[model samples]
Target: MNDPRSPAQDPDSGSGLADWTAGAADWIARADRIAAISRPATEILLARLDPQPGQRILDVASGAGDPAFSIAERVGSAGSVLATDGVAEMVTALEGRARERGLTNVQAQVVSAESLAFTPGRFDGASCRFGAMFFDDAARTFGAMATAVRSGGRLAALVWSCDDRNPYFTVVTAALDAVGADPVEVARTVFELDDPEEVLAACRGGGWVDARVEAVGFPWRLPDTRPETLIDTQSELSRKLRKRMEGLSADQIERARGIVAERVGQLEAAIQDGDDLIMPAECLALSGRAP
Candidate 1:
């Protein structure tokens, strides 16, 4: 789930919208890769939301639509999920993903979490993953999500815990920074929303009752991945860094890729789960109920 806030409206040049819009196809291609990492968090969020069959749900900032698709399976034929994101390109990709699976119960819409066009109290529950942190106005955007939930409905979100605990981003980011990347852009993502206190505050500000934040460790495994494959995945996954690195000569890019792979590969080898390369990661799962 995401803030639904469009990057074009974001004041910061590093807001991630331009690159995301320009390279949505890459994000779609790597959607399964992201799903591999986020699957665990989605389960945690689903448990928090507790959606039953016949319930109506919302997933904000549903980039590429994993948690949404997973939720659709949980809700089954009787239930429905409205997946949304302000990025039209993301929304389009989500639609295709849903169609590919023949998931008629889930629909993708281009909308912002800061301003929902849905009817009041229309949703039984709502969930977001890896989206809340990028919101232009988190309080208002999260609040808008809560507003869409019916009375006594639940809201759950997944966010990064701390950069130190997430080598998937930290190691590569550190390596990239060493090569003259913009610290502001590199530091802006997972690190920005790493604080649980901020997550709690956003829930409270969003007008949710009995809000709480908890830290959870997630295992990310890239199965049978080669160094080159890992580097390509990292390049596409790191939106900002990939955008900046595009201007580099092919040799420079390859060298930078090697540096990142070397750093991230160390993480890949740290813990191998079966033949898969496992990268240890952690996140904060925040949940609350609309009053």
Candidate 2:
């Protein structure tokens, strides 16, 4: 029996959800830039969802309005898409993006995954990308999502398969190590939990019935090979990390720079005579029905 309570209230929580809420606010101000980097993968996931007209969809942790706005297009004027996140900044950005797109079908709200205010069986379907893993209790968090959908409604979320499968973090970490930064000493705050069994168990614990997990593999391309890219990569984590790193010694900083430079050179070599620097990213797409 999972308690349906807001996970955000837990201060000592080990889950990175709290930090993500704050960090995402900062990220949304630069939403267009972030959206460009992740747009391809978002398109792939939405294509699979194929939301239909008249369907009421929920875009949980809808950062920067990409997924929600995308859903709005599919649902059209009759249907609606509720875009939500625990961070107010994200909600503000989402609303701004919706307004800019002239999308009246989308609404933004500040909501947490561990607890949702919507009535049970309220939604036709729901989807989240790279969001569920941040919960303090993944099982409790997903259980809430399950309760929000109608009996026949669908739920889907995307998470990393494992650390090694994604170069965005692994390559950058390797770069930090190349310049003499201790691997173990590096900020583990941006923790990525990708165990298939753990994820499945969480979904089941959340009252999801007949949940299915699919692997989505695609190339993640970064346009630039500069030190700025390294900073952007770190931004993908959290500001807490950025703040912590800001205190590092000049020599240590230089080492980190060298590591990133080496990784960039490798990526440049891997580029296939084109502007796109595609690197592989493996995602686990989990879908299930509400009981």
Q: Which sections of candidate 1 miss by over 4 Å?
A: 1-19, 179-188, 226-232, 244-269
Show where candidate 2 strays beyond 4 Å: 1-15, 177-191, 226-241, 248-254, 261-273
lDDT per residue (tens digit) for residues 48-71 in model 1: 988899888999889899899998
Per-candidate Cα RMSD to the true structure, in Å, reads: 3.9, 4.3
lDDT of each: 0.77, 0.70
Quote the lDDT for 188 in model 2: 23
TM per candidate comes to 0.84, 0.82
lDDT of 2 by residue, 1-291 (tens): 222323343334434555655456567766776677677668766765668998999888787887678789999999999888776667777888899999999987887766665788888888888877666677887877777788978887778778666766666666555555443322123235487777888888888888877777776766653543554455444454455455567777767767665665665333432544556678887888889
Cα displacement (angstroms), candidate 2, residue 166, comes to: 0.6
